[model samples]
Target: MWWSKSKVSSISSPLPCLCLLWLIVPACEAQQQDLGALLTAKCNSWNTKTTLSFPGDGSFANVTERWTVFAPPMYSAAISPATEEDVVKTVKLAAKYNISFLATGAGHGYGTTLGKLQNGLDIDLSQFKSISVNQSAGTVTVGGGVRMRDVIDAVFKAGFEIQTGSCSCPGFVGATIGAGVGRWSGIFGLIIDALVSVRLVTADGRIVQVSKTSNPDLFWAIRGAGANFGIITSATYRLHKIVAGANGGGQVMNADILVPANMSAAYFNALQSFSGKMPANLAAVSIVRYDADAGAAGILANWDYMGSEADGRRAMAPILALNPPVVSISTVPWNKLFATAGFGIDPVLCENNVIRDLYSANVRNLSASTMQAAFNKMGTFYSDHPEARGSVLELETFPNQAATSVPDGETAYPWRDALGNMIFLFSWDASTNSATSTAATKLGRQLRDDFVKTSGYPDLSVYVSYAHGDEKIEQIYGRNKLPRLAALKKSWDPRNVFAYNNALPTKYP
Candidate 1:
């Protein structure tokens, strides 16, 4: 899927002008002279047309014409900084003119918060991406914009491998700050769990280094929170040794049989059963999708096992015992197993319909019938929404001996007692379906709310990165940590320079 120079022109571009008037023009004269002037000045300063725009012509027209994309308004000049000085210069310029700025690496976030500044400078840090390991210190220093795959390649080359997300395109900085869950959770832990220090540029254009020793409050808050605190330039994380290519794979169980007629009731029961007999080494989740080519027929259940081939087989014996599988793929190496999960150089962008806290109460306390009932409703919803692809359920179990041992209030992330986390991912086309996309998003929210109520864990936490933007801030961070987070926001970004994100508003002095 790699593009060549000749093939580039043949491909149809989406939008040419990119709704410049709506975005570039500020809402008021004051904003115009401030934010607007900053943008124009920055674009002129860059003096390079290629740095000003994206490869695609896709713009506001695409969105108005039935694309539910939430691209930032004026992204004309995308500065690719290769060094920390570049970032400092950009930040200083932005601060001088009172113009909001956002930093993005791969821009793979589903939440619109990352790239939705009305009229601001976009600092694309892809060029700064580099990964180096210090064998003696057992620490790795990674550029903010380094893609997960690049880190993998670099760490692997250095004779060590760090746990990264499944998608290779997601960059390290944004992912780590926003809850870095991955395939190695059962043994290693989330990416944030391994972080030691970060280099950042604060709202007022002040560059600072933070860890347990310096600005510890900001350090703890930044790990699980989005980039509301500051712009991360680089990070130093602990490293681990990995088995190069451990044979990995799993089987798929039929959802119809597992989920009974009473959807919610059935889901709860299954949750209890699975929780009681949960295997530490095995990470599994159920998915629901209707085969459009097969005329809306029900197809459910998918699993991923990251152990050796024989070990994967032994771990999935219970799932296999559920019934014969419709599709089963296994291989050596964890990355190879995930490659089958669809992480190739595909042309289209993926929109995942995710519900973070599907199970509120401890699964062991839930009933099988309750779990079955939930699944039934989910199936019915899928049948109704034909465009909605199947849900990819994800479950990650971090080792108790690892970072989960950190107190709930210790970090900005408050969810500490859980055995693991789960996500119900549904993907759909980004083109020619504005109404369908909006409806599907609404449905996803409804599914999340219903599950929350059924599970009886009103306090269940949602990962800030995966959370819907419209959701209340307290829902993601929990009430216990809201005041502390707000104070940190006030201390670092008193003027709210990064307020455009899922920001914890400074309600107090």
Candidate 2:
């Protein structure tokens, strides 16, 4: 029963080997040829100004290198739509062939669930960048493909401001639909709260406008669960007048301080005390990282105040008293804050072809005991995996008055009561061996679990944008609202064509 390779080779005939090869090789070739023919036909049938990129085409490389490179999907083909009608036609064609598809704009989404989409059509919406500002009405209508930087530039030109994510690369529409959290959210509101209406192309290839008065049920679902309903072609949001300074234009005060490893514990205590009574106009975040080369851990605190330098100093007094090693503070124009604050506008931070595991947890308060345990665990993790020296833990205690102002049942976003959002970011080079990546991922998961247990919060809700793709639907959206979201999924996306990113099934388990 146990024959060696020598014995098998002694009895092998050339005809048998040739027969085995003939059976497998032609089948694979036929499948590839059929897919090529199908993609060719689809490209020829498009009625709008669209471009198609196939698997081996030169343009395919750029289309696929949008975000995290870990387990990137091997899409059959990509189509770039120039207009809203182009999106409608592509969706209809994909439906005709029963081919699942995903619409991508900036392609900056972090959810790992996107890797589940295999050999599907990619509907690239990056070409629909258009911005229109209604000065009299105090509103702005932006195309789906517009980025945060584009929105800020256009609104600032007209003496207006809108709530947007800290990063400038994410699509504005995509961020708003997922309950956008921004630096100005404490003053204005969450981005979703400012949404007036959205123009969407549904699964049935129909273009419809959704708002409170029109399609009220669908409107309620789209605010937080927008990705599951349809592809948004464009959106309109209410804008506010820029917070003008005493002289004339608006200004913001930015601060960055570095705390040595010895003072990290004291700094954390100060942060907890300050966060409990934070001002509505102030936003703060602390980052902790361990470096193997340096053989030490440090913390960085970044703060921004929407006022003059004097007011900023008064608000940041507690953090300043920590006596950090490095301190940099400056006052700049409202539009220049992103560049000066160094929070956004970094291209290399999110470079293509990098592997990362992002996780989040919501807590009511950061107890001293929990903070110490987190610091110790991070140190141990870094020591165990020297290759992941770039890992970090971010604690954001910004004032979220506008985000928490809405009632829980009013929107699909369920984490309205949480005071702080904790993010665990583990990143490493993709070329590392598989064992290293696997160990880093395991360590990240363990740290999150330990932190949640130590925090003593029974509600384990997480931010949707920071999810790791393994959490249940109830964990992201609360248990009380899962049935309703499931019902909406059944009514709108009955076939579940757009079930790629943090998918919600058509029926509840």
List the candidate 1 regions with Cα displacement exceeding 4 Å.
Answer: 1-77, 114-116, 243-272, 297-302, 327-329, 342-371, 389-403, 419-438
Per-candidate local distance difference test = 0.56, 0.74
Q: What is the TM-score of each candidate against the true structure?
A: 0.76, 0.89
**Predicted structure 2, TM vs. truth:** 0.89
lDDT tens digits, residues 215-305, model 2? 7788888777788889998999999887556422467888888777778788888777864567777887777787444586777678888
Residue 285 in model 2: lDDT: 74
Model 2 lowest lDDT segment of ten: 1-10
Error of 1 at 374 (Å): 4.3
Residues 225-327, candidate 1: write the lDDT tens digits.
7478888888999987654453222221111123223242433344455553445445544434344554433424434455564665566565555443244
Residue pairs in steric clash, candidate 2?
none
Q: Which candidate achieves the best lDDT against the true structure?
A: 2
Error of 1 at 246 (Å): 11
